[model samples]
Target: NEQISKYAVQDPELEGMGTTCVVVMLKEKEVFFAHAGDSRLYLLRNGKLAPLTKDHSRVQEMIEKGEITPQEVLSHPERSLITRALGMENVLEPEIGQSFEAGNGDKLLLCSDGLYNMLSNSILEQILTENAAAQDKAIRLVQRAKDAGGYDNISVQVIEFQFKEQKIILPTTPLNFFEKNIDESSENISPTIPKVVKEKKIVDEEKVPKSEVKNTFQPKPEMSEKTPPAVKTGKKVPDIALIVLLVLFGVVLTLFFLGSGMTKDPKPSELNISQTPDTNAVAEPMNEEPLDNQQETTAITTPKKDEKPVTKPEKPKKIPKDTLISYTVQAGDNLRKIAQRFNMKTETLKKLNRLDDNEIKTDQKLKIKVRTVHTVAAGDVLSRIADQYKTNRELIKKANDMTDNATKRGTKLIIPLAKAE
Candidate 1:
C-alpha cells in the first residue's frame, strides 16, 4: 500500500478528484473484501443478510460514537461527508475487511452508498430472498433504487458461488520415449512363470468346451479417458510347452554325462602308458662330452721323466702329553726355522700357530704349553734328535731352534713343542 501511494495520484492539477465509496471482493472458500469511504459488502445466507465491510463516512462515525441515533442518520447533513476516499492525496489507507466463510449457493452483494440510501433494509432483504439468479437479483436491486428517486450514481454487483469436485484427465496417446524404454525392459524379463495373454480380445467363457483346457484372458472392449492401460502379456501356450521340453532335455543330458564318466577298475598290465622311463629312449643326455680330455688331464699331472711324486711333509708326533713352551721369534727366522728351533714339524708348527705361510717376524712370542725340554748334544743332528725322541726330523729341528739343516752343541730346545689345543 505504501509503495502504491508513493507512485499514485501523480496529477496535482486535479482537485477534489476523489470517490465517496469503493468496494472490492475476491471469491474463494474464504471471501475477501476491501473498502475505503462509504461502500458496502453484504453476504446473503439462509435468507439473512450480513455486512462484511463497514462505511467510513461521517454519519457512520457519529452513529458509532453515539453522537447521533440510527434514526437520525438518514436525514443527517453529515451523511454525505465521507472520511476516506481514493485519489484524494498521494497515499491511501483502505480498510482490509475481515474474511467470511463462503460455500455453495452463497451470494455476495456489493453496492455503493447511493443504492443503499434510496432503499430500506427490508426491501433489500426481500429482493435478495427471491428465487432468482445473481444477475436477476442485481438488476432488480439497482432498478428498485433508481425507481425510488436515486439522485446519486448507483452501482451493484452480485455473485452466486458453487463448489464441485475437480479432476484432471491425462491424454491417451502412444507411449513416449522414456515409457517405451521401460516397457521394452519389462517385456525382455524372462521369469519362469511369465504371465501370458490369450489370442482372443473377448472371451465368451460359457461357450468354451468342457473337454478342452484353455488359459483364457479378457481385454477391454473399448478405450476411454478413465480406462487403465492394457497389460502386455507374453507368448501364450507355446512358452509353457517350450519350458517343459527344455527341462526334460537338461535332465537327460545330465544323466548321459554321469553314465559316460563311470568305468570298472583295471590291472597294471592293462594300463595305457606308451613307454617306461627305464628304456634308453628317455635316459641319454642331449649334451654329453667325450672322455679323452679327462684322460689327458691325468697324463699332464703325472710329470714324466726324473720328476718325483711330491708328497706332503708329515706332521711330528704329539707333544709329550699336552705340555707346551713359549718361544720368542728371533732375527732371520721363518716358520720352518721356528719349528726346527722348537723341535716340531714345520707343518705342525704352522698349524699350531695358525700361520698363513712359513713367514715369521722377529721378537714375536709364540705360546706352547711346555710338557718336556731337550738339550742338543755335541754329536746330535736334528734327525738323530727326532729318532731318539720317536719324533720327525722337523720336530728335532724345531726343538733344537735350528732355522736350517744345522746343529749346534749345547743348544736348549723345546722338544716337540705343541700349542694349546
Candidate 2:
C-alpha cells in the first residue's frame, strides 16, 4: 500500500495527481481500511454512527499534538488542509486498521470530506438506516452533499451486509417412490436436514437376516373312515348320561348353598369377625442392614467437611526495572518538550531525574528511562534486535553506551521505545 503512494510521489507525471485515498477491504465480516488525507470512512452499526478512519489533516495533527481541541477542528481555517497524502512527498504513511468487526445490518460508508463537512454524523446515520439499496444510498448521499452547498468533489461508497436464513426442504415424495437413491443409508446424511425414511423392501436382502421372518400357515391330514370308533363313541352314552345327572344334582345343591350364603345378608357376628391369621404362613421381609454399607460408601466418595485440601499461593508478577540512559539536550529542548518527544509524562521525568523544574540548558546530559534491556546472544545483530523490539539501531546504541559500530556477541543493550530528538 505504501509502495504505490511512494511511486506516485516520485513520478513526475503524477505531479497533479496528489489526492486523498481511502481503500477498504472486507474479509469474513471484518472491515479493514487504509486512509490518507481528509477522506473518511464511517460505520453505521447497531444504530450508531462511528468514524473508522481519521483524516491526515492539519487540524487532526493539532488535535494529536494537544495544540488544539477536537471541537475547534470543525471551524479551523486549516481543517481542509491535509498534512499527509499520496504524491505529496517521497514517502507516505497512511493510517490503516482492522479493529472493526462488521456483521449483518452493518453499513460501511466511504466518502470524501465534502459529505462529512456538510452533514452531521446523526444525519448520516439516519440516511444510512433508511430502508434503501446501497447504490441508491450512495447516490442520495452524494446528492445531499451537493445540496448542502458542497463545491468540493463529492464521492460516496456504501456497503451494507445482511444475513440470510438457511432452510433444507425435503422432496415431497415417499421413501419407496424414490427407489433409485434408497440403496444409500439414511443415517449418514445431516441430522439437521429432513430426510425420507427408506421402506423395508428397499433394504438389500443380504443386509437383512432370514431368521427374523416366520411362516404361520400349515397343512393337516384329513380324518379317514377306516379309523372307526376311536373311543366306542355313543355306546356308553347311557351310563355317561346317568353319571352326568348325578353330577348335575350335586352342582345344583352346591349352587343352592352358595345362593343361600349370599342371601343371608352377612350376619352381624360374621361381619364383625376378622380373618384368622394362620400360624404356618410366612412372608418375606426387607432387610435394612445395608444402610450402614451405603453410608460407608458415601463417606468414601465425599470429602470431609472439616478437612480442606491446601492450595499454594501464586507468586506475584515482578515489575521490570527501566534502564537508565543519558540524553544529550538539544536546541529548544526543555524537560516538558523532551518528555513529550519520548511519549512520557513530564512529572515522571522530573521525579526520575530529580529535576526541580522544566528548565534545562542545551548540551546538558539528562537521565531518561528506557523501558527494556536485552542481552545479545549467538547470531544476534543490531538490525535484527531492533526489528525484534520495534526500535532503531541508533537508539539501541545510544541506550547501550556504544559508538556507531556493530555490536559484538554477548553485548547487552537497552531498547528505548522513545528517545529525545
Q: Tell me the alpha-carbon RMSD of every candidate.
A: 59.2, 42.2
The total number of steric clashes, by the backbone 3 Å criterion, in model 2 comes to: 0
lDDT tens per residue, model 2, 80-183: 44555654433444555454555556778888876776666666777888776667677777767657655456778887755433222223433233245656
Best by lDDT: 2
How many backbone clashes are present in model 1?
A: 20
Give lDDT tens digits, candidate 1, residues 58-166: 5565565456666566544334455555543234455555555565456777888656766665677788877766667777777787676554556887776544332
The lDDT, on a scale of 0 to 1, for candidate 1 is: 0.49
Best by TM-score: 2
> Could you tell me every candidate's TM-score relative to the true structure?
0.36, 0.37
User: What are the Cα lDDT values of the candidates?
Assistant: 0.49, 0.52
- Return the TM-score for candidate 2, rounded to 2 decimals: 0.37
